[model samples]
Target: MKSHIAALLLATSAVFPALAQTLAVKTSAPERYVVKKGDTLWDISSLYLNSPWKWPALWQWNPQINNPHLIYPGDVLSLHYDSEGNPRLSLAKGVRRLSPQVRVVSDKNQAIPTLPLAVMEPFMRFEQAMGESDFDQLPMVLGSNFNYKMNIEGHLLYVKGDLPRGGNYGIYRKGDAYRDPDNGAILAYESILVGTGRVVRTGNIEAGKPSTVKIESVRREVKPSDVLMPISSGQSYSANFKMTQPVQAISGNIIASSNKLREFSTMAVVVIDLGRKDDLHEGNVLAIHRQSPTVIEKESGPSYIEDASSLDKVITQVSEWFGEENDEDSVVWHMPKEQVGELMLFKVYDNISYAMVTKTRQPVRVGDSVSSR
Candidate 1:
C-alpha cells in the first residue's frame, strides 16, 4: 500500500509539470500582426487562409470592421494562440498588431492596354449617322389642291376668286394669287410665301380681296383658289407632316436575275428607283412587303404548352444599284450577287430616293406597294 501511494504521487507531479508548461506557453503566445500600406485585408486573408474568399470570415471576427470597405491603412490583425503556441484566427481585439508597409512589384514590362477592334466593331457598324443624299433630291409634292388642307389653330379657310378650294394647298401664311379680271386665267402664285399655315376658317371673300381667315399661327401665303383644308390632327398627321421630306421608292421586281444580281438569299431583293443620278448612296433602307404570314399554335399533352409556327420569310437587308437611263439592261452597282430579303430604305440616295418600312404585322414584299408609312 505504501509503495503504491508513492508511485501515484510521482505520477501526479509529472502530469502537473506538463500541464503547467502548456498553460505558460499559451499565456505567453504572440499573435501580433503589422499592417502594411497598399495591403488590403483580402491579400492578407489570402496569405493566411486556404481560400481568399474567406476574408469575409476574418472580417466578421473583427467587430472594428463594420464593413469590408472600412478597412484602411495602419489596421492591425490579431490571431488567437493555442496551448501549443499555434496561431488561430479569432475576433478578440487584443490578439493582433499593426505592422509595416507591404510592397508588390511586377516582373514583366507593362504595356499600355488597348481595346480590341472586335470590341469596337459593333459601334463602327452602327448605321445611325449614315447620309441621306438621295432623299434630299427626290421630287416631293407640296400640299397641292389635290392632297392636303390647311387650318389655323382649329379653323378652316376658304379662298376667294374662281379658284378651286379643298385641294392640296401649300399653307403659306402671307402670299396670295391675283386673278386677271379680263381673261380669268390663273395668275402667278406669290414667290414670297412667308410661312406654311393651314386655313382654319373657309369662307368666300370678294374676288382679288383679302378674306377673314385664321391662318396657321403666322402670316405666309395662300394660292387664291388653292385647295384649303384643315390639317389632320393626331399622331398620324404628325408623322405625315414629317413625311413632307422627299424619300426614295423601290422599283422593279425583288427577285434574282443573272444580269442585275447583287446579293441573294432565300428572300428577295428589289431595285431602288433612285441611284447615282437621283443621288442615291450606299446604306439606304427600303421597305418591302408581302402577305402576312399565318400563325398557328400546336397542342401538346395537358401539362405542356405547344409551340407556335409562322410561315413566310421576313425582309432583311437592302442593297443599292444604279442603272442607265435609256438602257434598262445596264447594271450599275449590285450589293449582293443574288437577291435576298428586301431592305427598308430608311436611308436615302442623293436623288432624294429614300423610304421606310411600314413595320406591320403583315410582312411587306416587292410589288406590294410601299409608301411612307
Candidate 2:
C-alpha cells in the first residue's frame, strides 16, 4: 500500500530529441488554427503531424510556447517552419477575436489538455488499483435510513464500524478482479465507485454499533454492504500533466482495460504491468505490439527458445501456426512482433500503471506488448 502511493510520484524524462528531428507537417494541415474550448493537444497534433504521439516534441521545437500543454482556448496558433524548414507552431497567447462593433474580454483558467479529458477524467478523479486485502477491510453500508433495499441520493445510509465524524466517503462495490494474463496471478481487485456520502452520526466499534451517513451524490444505485472509502481532500482530477519519453528500453503487458473489454481501440485507457519500478513516468510514449505468431517452417532444427525477460508478460502456447506439425523435416518459426498502436502513461503505481491509447492502426488487446517507441 505504501509502495503504491510512493510510486505515484514519478520523475519526467528529458524531451524526445530524436523524435523531434523527424517531425513533419501533414500536407493538409491548417495554416492557422484557433484553439477552441473542446480542443485537445492530440486532436490538434493529429491535424498537423502524421504521428499524434509526437505532439510533445513538436511543442519542444517552439521557444514561444514555454509550456507545451499551456495553450488556452483563446490562443491563436500558426503553422510555420523554422529557418531549417522544420515544422514549428507559433503561439499568440489569449488572443480574443473582436468585431468592429463590439469589444469584450474574459478571464479563463482552462488550458488545452494533452488528451481528451472526458475519456479519462473518471479514472483520474476516483478510480484506483488495489490488492485484495485493501478492499476487504473498508467499512460498508449496512442499510439506508428506513432499511430500504434501494440506496438512493439524499438518503441516510447506515455504515458498519465507527467512521471519522463529518468525513466524506465514496460508496463503492467490488468489481471483477484483474489477473495477469500470462500466469493468471490476481493483480488487483477493482472497487467500482458508485456515490459520495458523509458521516453525520458516529458509532462505537467496541459496542458493535453502525454509523449513519447521508448520501450527497449518487452515480449508480447503492445497496447494503457496499464499501465506503474515505475521500482525500487533495484528490486531483487534473488533465494538465507532463508527457515524456522513457530514456531506456522498456516493455510490459496490457493487463486490463475499462469494462473488462477484451479489445479496445484508440483513446481507450488501459492498465499495464510496467510502472515507476520500470522507470516509467507520465507523458512517456510507448508502442503497442500484437503478439507474434509461431509458424511451422521447413528449417534445420526446432526454433523455440524462451526469453527470460518477458517470461511473465508474454503468454506462450504450444501450438503450430501452420497446418504441418514439427517433425524432422520441419521446425517451428516465430514471426517478428508487429506494431499496432501507441499509448502514453498518465499515472504510475508500484507494479502497474494507467495509460491512454493515443493512436491505433489496429485494435489493442490484453497481453499486447508495450515498449519504448
Candidate 3:
C-alpha cells in the first residue's frame, strides 16, 4: 500500500510542468493553507491567484487521494515550484482511497458545490422556456373548490387539460413576456412556479371533464387560469453545481435577474440570452463584462450671437430653441471590455440560460455583456 501511494504521487508530479506553466500566482499568496468545509475551488483559487478561472492549470491531482479534485474539510494544500519554475498546487494531505470504487453519493453532504446552491436553486427549479404554441395547449387551472378565487394547501383544483395519471405536476402562473434582446420578437414565455400538486383524478378532456388536483404544497397563491406542468426531475435545472472550464466561446447579454432587480451580486442568478444553440452547457463558465460609458468629445466653441434685426434670423433662432440638438460629428470612442464577474451556467434552453454569479470584482447589472472566450 505504501509503495502504491508513492508511485501515484510520483506519476502526478512528473506531468506537473505542462499543466502548471503559464499559471500566475498572486504576489501575496500563502505558501500553505488548510481547506475547510463549504470552501469551493474558486474560493480557494482566488486566495492564490488574481484570476480564479486558471485554477485547473495550477491544480495538481494525486491519484492516491479519493476525489482529489474535491478538497474536503481539514485537508491541507501547499504551493510548490517545479524544476522549470512553474507554480504548482498540490494536495499535501487529504482523505485517501487505495483503489477506485463506484458508489452513490449525496451532493448535499459529499460534494463541494461550486457556489451557494440554496440561493440559486429556487430561481432554477421551474424556470422553463417554451414557445407560444406550446403554452397555448398546456393545462390550466379552471377553478378551485366552490369556485374560490384563491387556492391554498389542501384545496381541490379543477384543471382543463389531459393530465397524466398518477403523477405530480408543478403549478405555474404566466409571467412577464420574454422578448428577444436582439430583436423585439417574442422568443419564449416565462413560467413562474407557484406550487406542486398531484393529479388526484384525471378526466376526459374530449368529453369536457376537468381533472381534479389536490394541492400538496403552496409557495404563492395558486389561482384559476394558472398553468400546470409536469414536475422537472432530472432536468438541467435540477443538476448539482459543478465548476468547470468554458468548453466553447459564447457572447450574450443579461436580459433578466432574480427579484427583478436592476443589479445583483455574487450568489445571485441572472438570465442570459445565450443557450444550448450557442453550445453552452451546464458548468460552462462565462465572464460578465461591463463596458465603460461611451465617450463623446465636443470641441470648445463660442456661443453664436442671435440678432433679431431680420425676420429670417428670428425664425432660425426660434427653430433652434425648440429643436433637438444632434451630435453628428462628435468623436465616439469604444470602451474597452472589463471582466467584472464569472457565472456558471446551470440551466440552459434553446435561447436562454440561468447562471449563478460565482465571483465578482464589480457589481453585476442588467444589460451587461457576457462571454466565455
Best by lDDT: 2
Tell how far residue 209 is off in model 3, in angstroms.
Answer: 2.1
lDDT of 2 at 145: 71
Per-model TM values vs. the true structure: 0.18, 0.79, 0.76
lDDT of 3 by residue, 283-358 (tens): 7778899887544333643223332225434544464587744345333344588988888888888888888887
Clashes of each: 84, 2, 0
Scored by CA lDDT, what does every candidate get?
0.32, 0.75, 0.72
Q: Write the per-residue lDDT of candidate 1 for residues 267-352, one digit (tens) a residue.
A: 22233334456433433333344433322222331111122211101111111223223123221222222222333333333322
- Weakest ten-residue segment in model 2 by summed lDDT: 5-14
Error of 1 at 198 (Å): 5.5
For candidate 2, give the lDDT of residue 245: 61
Residue pairs of candidate 3 with colliding backbone atoms = none
